[model samples]
Target chain A: MSHTTKEKSKLLARIRRLKGQMEAVERALEAEMPCGDILNLVASVRGAVNGLMGELIEDHIRMHVVDPGTETDSERAKGAADLIDVVRMYLK
Target chain B: MSHTTKEKSKLLARIRRLKGQMEAVERALEAEMPCGDILNLVASVRGAVNGLMGELIEDHIRMHVVDPGTETDSERAKGAADLIDVVRMYLK
Candidate 1:
């Protein structure tokens, strides 16, 4: 089973929250809210999405790359660290 | 008028696309796809969101901060640039 299969419920919950956030943005626009207020909403949504991405990436690293806690291979550990750095930069 | 009000259609279109992307992520998880594929879907959604945030941030700068084209105030220009830097860091 894929790692995500194990975390399906948690991941689905996050997606549902994201859907709600998108709906909130729609409502804000419909209400013709101020730009600053809308910006704050967008910022919150962006933060949530980043949080979700971080969770998925961490799981990927643990399941696919290296667990880090129980890993004894120096090369694999370094590779996992490097992959994480790249993912962070890309997500940024 | 808020800058977003002027760009409402375009912004809403982006949001709609984001909603679609979120649905795609849900479907992928439900289908029990591999973690790597799910990661890619999440990455795409992240990119779409960052694109939307960038648009909002740029408009915020142009309308609220400084136009950068016609602004003669060095202080305001510097401030806008600094705000953009901070935003980029936060979004990352």
Candidate 2:
């Protein structure tokens, strides 16, 4: 079973919340809210999406790259760290 | 007229696309797709949300903080730059 499958419900919850946030953005735009308010909304959505990405990336690293707690492979650990850095840069 | 108002349609289009991306994530999960593929989907959604945030932040800075082309206040420009840095950090 994939780690994502194990965490399916949790991940879906986050996506559902994200959908709600996007809908809020839609409503805010429809109401013609000011740019500052809209920016705040967009920022919140961005933050939430970042949170989701962080979770998935962490799981991917732990399950696919290296399970740090059990693995003693220094090379794999280093590679996992580098992969994390790249993921951070890409998401950022 | 707020910059967001002027760019309302563009922003909405981006948000709509994000919604679709999120739906894809949900569907993928339901289908028990592998974590790697799911992560890629989430990453694309994150990218799109980041793009939306970038647009709103730029508009907010120009309209509220400092319109670089028109504003001559060095202090305000510096402040806007600092705010952008903080925003980028927060989103990251």
Candidate 3:
């Protein structure tokens, strides 16, 4: 089974939250909120999105790249570590 | 600047790749590809999406949660580490 399928409900909950955040941004825009306020609202929505994305990526890494728990292969572990390192560096 | 904006071109490239993968899935469906093959194509798209999401999350962490390089505040570092731990656990 796909990782997403395994965690479908949790993923959906996060998505729903993201949707709500997006809707908030939309409402702010519609209401002609101040630009700064709108920008802040948009930033929150983006952060929510990033959180969701981070969760998915971590799941993908576990499912496809390496399962940190049972992974005994050094090469594969190294690969996963490398990927994580890149993620950190890129994020920085 | 928003991390996304700072890395706009790179992000766009990743998005373009994802779009291409999605288009391939669409094409496979239209061409009556075997179910297994279509499923594989969909998986590829999902992985691409996961990659993109992972990058965004990392960026968000760097921009908002903690800048690993210059994070001098122990409390914030702990908070970020806690978040990363949760991310790893959830992903697993």
What DockQ does predicted model 3 obtain?
0.04
Once superposed on the true structure, which residue ranges of model 3 sit more than 4 Å away at CA? A1-92, B88-92
Q: Looking at model 2, give its docking quality level.
A: medium
Pairwise TM-score winner, candidates 2 and 3: 2
What order do you get sorting by TM-score, best first?
1, 2, 3
In order, what lDDT does every prediction score?
A: 0.85, 0.83, 0.58
Candidate 1: which pairs clash? A92-B92
Top candidate on TM-score is 1
* lDDT (tens digit, per residue) of candidate 3 on A7-84: 656655555555455456455545555444644655564455455445556667777669756789988887887776
Local distance difference test, candidate 1: 0.85
Q: Give the TM-score of candidate 3.
A: 0.47
Off by over 4 Å in 1: A69-92, B70-92
**TM-score value, chain A, candidate 1:** 0.78
Expressed as tens digits, the lDDT of each residue in B1-92 for candidate 3 is 56656665665555556545545645554555544464465555445544555556666777856975579998888788777666545432
When 2 and 3 are scored with lDDT, the better candidate is 2
Error of 3 at A43 (Å): 14
